[model samples]
Target: MELSVEQAAELRELVNSRDVPADIATRGRIVLWSGKGRRRKDIAELLGVSLPTVDRWKARYAERGLAGLEGERPGGAREQMPARVRSRVIALTRMTPPAGTGLSHWSTRELAKYLARTENIVVSWHYIARIWREESLKPHRSGTFKISKDPAFAEKAADVIGLYLAPPGGAVVLSIDEKTQIQALDRTQPVLPVAFAATGKRTADYVRHGTTNLFAALNVTTGEVLGECRPTRNGKDFLTFLKKAVKPHAGKDIHVVLDNLSTHTTWEVKEWLSKNPHVHFHFTPVGSSWLNQIEIWFGILTRQSIRRGTFSSVHVLVKQIRDYINSWNTTAKPFTWTATAGEVLAKARLVATNMKKIVNNNSN
Candidate 1:
């Protein structure tokens, strides 16, 4: 009926130690509950033990203190799971199920059923799930990686990354790109503004007003974003925006990081570049848009401003974009490129190696 501080503390410690047998830990928990003035019948029901089993452990602790709790069992101790079972669980997770088994991937329930029928080993789905977690095995999920195949990938990626890390003194580094065909969309119904208890809500359907292209340049030295909404995304419009962007910074040399779009390499653009020798251009590798940090700024703008905004017409949409860019300029910090060119190239090579293995396996 009563417990000294030492006795209560010992029982609590044993209940928390995972090294002990489950039955022994349950016993310790039962005694701790009984110490809290729980009846023998209530402790037995709470722990899923019979009244007599509860009485046995409580009596043991009362008589011999902590020593009586370690009474002898049929086996000295329960053994850990065999290595063979663990390995089989991991191997099955990494493979596709058999053709006749009606399973594309191994689910925990299906695995347990398979083991019961074929291996004569019975385990609950929960036990199999524990093993899967311990081994970090997931049979139903996958990921994708791309290795750019641009013949000039190495040099192009190096040049872009170099501009980000170190630029010529007194020269402005600009990341320039265009986000085209941005729809001027109006929600079908009125939106509910956000409140403390819930998030803002918008109609799933929208009315299309039209589309416009956004040509933007991000100043790498200062986080200022300059953007123009153009009716066309042709070389002529691109050149026009380029001239406007470079006009103020005319006296200083500028290095621009961009993608290899046809409009950017047109004869007019090329001739203009030749005329302004101080204006240098470095292209990011095909399929490696992540090397350019301006795209990151665009993503932020889309999420915070454009995605949720409801525009009634092309003019309103353009004005909204211009306003967002102007506001973004007030608090712009240069995006940092922490990875070295060597590290990126090494990762690309690893991706290439993995892709080759996948291709070869598919061929076989």
Candidate 2:
């Protein structure tokens, strides 16, 4: 049941009055309760207030009503940035930070300080952090930031990506990339299985001795991996791997996708390529290593097989990597391209914009 204006006002007055004693405050609650059920006598007894006094309060309340209620306190620090200012702050962060700032991106503290100084808008670091999280612009460390500097980057990239997207009929599109000097690491202490609690314990210890290089070419459509391993992934080693990867697809126009590495286009390798008219080379765009599906496979290999591995020598590392590849090929499947060409182009445009900003900044 809704409260009568009189009863609400009576309760409010009792709650707010400085002279009202605790017992009377108790009576005010009773008044509301009794008024709710039309139980005046019970309310009077419960509050220890005279029934007549309750009636008078209730009558006064019916007249004064909700206006007699309390109000909020007026003093507090204002919000750091209003909605509009917060959006502006995000816009500034997305752009490059000021030159000579010795920082690639703005830390929340730096951004907050900048806002306060430049816009005369004061905001707490907590709020700034919240905004970054909300905007999905939090700074993170990723290996992808390391980029290749290929001058013929775009042309090379288009060729490679095209092979994957539209390979010549009855021809193979192989994406080749090299992971050089991978160190084999073994855990210092033995790893224990969770099931063994008290006994039947076994321990194994290991160390990282040295590194070896891997050159792999993957058939994008077939999930077939063909390549070689060498102590040094120099020009010779790269070319050797290339020949091995290409020989199987000989007599046809085989599209070989690789990054623009110094050794890849050496005179020796080029001479070999010229002799094999049927073989073709495609290069990934500069700075966009993510275009290669093999890169994704490399990440999986590192996480699942390479990391924390202790190989006694380069021979052992090479063997392990080869074993992993064989195992993978046995059950490997082609990666489905859910990202359409149009979507990729849209993202590429954004990346181009960011790169232009960087180049412009460098020029200035």
Candidate 3:
């Protein structure tokens, strides 16, 4: 297709610019000479270049148009397997490997070997790597192994996401999750509080004093976080923390979304939930922790505030966490959930179902 007006202007500017290399200028001149149907000898003499260079430019321009002039040669053999081969490769990758290989998915080397041995195709590891990327397939990975075991996952996900989709007035929707075993470091040399002066200095070397757990509840509408430091992350400890944290906003029903941890749904927690009818629990799907917005907030807390702090004791650790929260509540803002329920459903349900059908569709 012909270049657009803007594109043509850009090309003209690029061609005239001082930064434009002589090779590119030569190619453009060659095209101009060819437009007049000039002989290679005449063109080479006019440009004061070799006849062979003129011939090479003419051949490249004839074969690949403007793309070849930019040093992108298109002379390599066409992909042997084609798009059909790539589709087959992805399908085979999802299948269980041969019995002895003891692998669930195919590695690049293993795939190359499989193709060479079984399909009579002389495939290379490099080719397999390129094709896999071209087809948007990655080698076996831990995080990529996701199985949707929750049958009622979609329905439950909708209900949970809907709370944030449009929350009730005067009632806050908090995405609550626990960051267990947060280590507290103690400086061997007592960290003298630095005064606001010309020489504001503090100690750096520190020692770790075991670990403490942080039970954090983040108000999705308002970015205010209420966090408590617990000795352990058991059900009783979580319940106690929740009781203390929820005291500030008691009258309204607190809809807390947490992961499906055993401690979160213990008998003690169940009993507490029964007594506190105003507090409701919504659990994320079995393997879908990414759905929790609190996880993202926790990551920020770890990265920005908590990672490089020295704490003398649990009390100091708790104080620091509280101080950070207080500072954050002043300026911290809640994250906007852009992925709507419909968009999530499309990705999780519709896309997954179609992918499965496509995987199983090939009549092999």
Whichever of 1 and 2 has more lDDT, that candidate is 1
Count of clashing residue pairs in every prediction:
0, 5, 0
Instruction: Give lDDT tens digits, candidate 2, residues 1-364.
Output: 3564533433544543444444445445544565557577776654456888767656544544322221122476443455666666666655445544544456666787787888787875546655665676644222233223456655555566566667789888888888877886554433233312344332223455787888888889888777567778788888888888887876777877776578989999999988987888766665556677777788778767776366777777888999999999999897764554455556656755776665455446
In model 1, what is the error at residue 293, expressed in angstroms? 1.8
Candidate 3's displacement at residue 246, Å, is 1.9
Candidate 1, position 213, lDDT: 95
lDDT of 3 by residue, 185-290 (tens): 7644422223212243322335667787888888888878888777788888878877876778889978888878888888998998899998888887765555
Candidate 3 residue pairs in backbone clash: none
Global Cα lDDT for candidate 1:
0.73
**Candidate 3: stretches off by over 4 Å:** 1-147, 184-209, 307-320, 350-364
lDDT-wise, the better of 2 and 3 is: 3
Give me the candidate number with maximum lDDT. 1
lDDT of 1 by residue, 1-105 (tens): 787554564565566454556566677766777886989987776567799998898898787655456676576763466666665665555544654685536
Q: All candidates' TM-scores?
A: 0.57, 0.54, 0.53
Model 3 RMSD, rounded to 1 decimal: 17.5
Order by TM-score, highest first:
1, 2, 3
Ranking by lDDT: 1, 3, 2
